[model samples]
Target: MSEENNIPSNAPVFQIQRMYLKDLSLEQPNAPQILLEQTQPQVDINLALSAEPVAEGVFEVCVTGTVTTKVGERTLFLIEAKQAGIFEIRNVPQEQVEGILGIVCPQMIYPYLRAIVSDVCTRAGFPPVLLTEVNFQAMFEAQQAQREAAASPTLN
Candidate 1:
């Protein structure tokens, strides 16, 4: 019982120190002319997530979203938003940390990215572009599968 009391604390700790918009850009190349067109432009959106260790127990996670709208051959507008957070995670097993960063961190930052994208589009004088919800677990699993496949040998 006494030895148990002497053991150092290894309790898990996870916290978000801060969340911020690291970068934002909007481009409207065909501004006035494109605005006059009555036809709706087709919208395309892409997303990516990354995490890196900033300190011994702190990490920086970022989710980047890009949106492009085009009417026929002309480009109506384009926007890219990168949302980031500083997270402090300690005492978690090494194997689990990757999952937490890949899934949980992206899940937390995605909403902010979506909102920023919508707001940027609306403020640029076009209709708001709503981003669809993402399933990070499925994405992570797919990425893992691809990595494994690339590493495995292919039979001729």
Candidate 2:
């Protein structure tokens, strides 16, 4: 038992402390008039991910999605949902931490954001808008590429 005391723990630790809806908003400018339209409304979705360090080993990640449905020039319904999670990331390399926060954390919280958007649209008297699966890895790669390009000097 005395020999075990000499050993040190170097295992990585990552956990979600809590997940909650940080913000939500629903707007129906056309309302009854828009509902009367016989044509199918077009939907446009926008997504964003953000991370902030709250404590020494704790971070907050937010996944935000906005859905807008329009019938011609008029608006049918617009809903925005923000889902956030508090994560504890310790014993991890500093360089890898950014990727974990950008890709892994957002992937974990995106489903909840999608559900909220669908539920809000359905409850507001519209068909449930099923959100497609997002590729966080690709997004992260693109952002990194853009940063690298910006930092490099233009030859022209």
Local distance difference test, each candidate: 0.91, 0.91
The segments of candidate 1 whose C-alpha lies over 4 angstroms from its true place after superposition are 1-8
Q: Mind giving the per-residue lDDT tens digits that candidate 1 earns over 57-76?
A: 99999999989889998988
Error of 2 at 123 (Å): 0.8
Question: Compared with the true structure, what per-residue lDDT tens digits does model 2 show for residues 1-156?
Answer: 236765346667799999999999999988787677799888999998899999998999999998888888888888989999999999899978999999999999998988898899789887899999999999999999999999999996
TM-score of candidate 1 on Cα atoms, chains taken together: 0.92
Candidate 1, residue 91: Cα displacement in angstroms equals 1.3
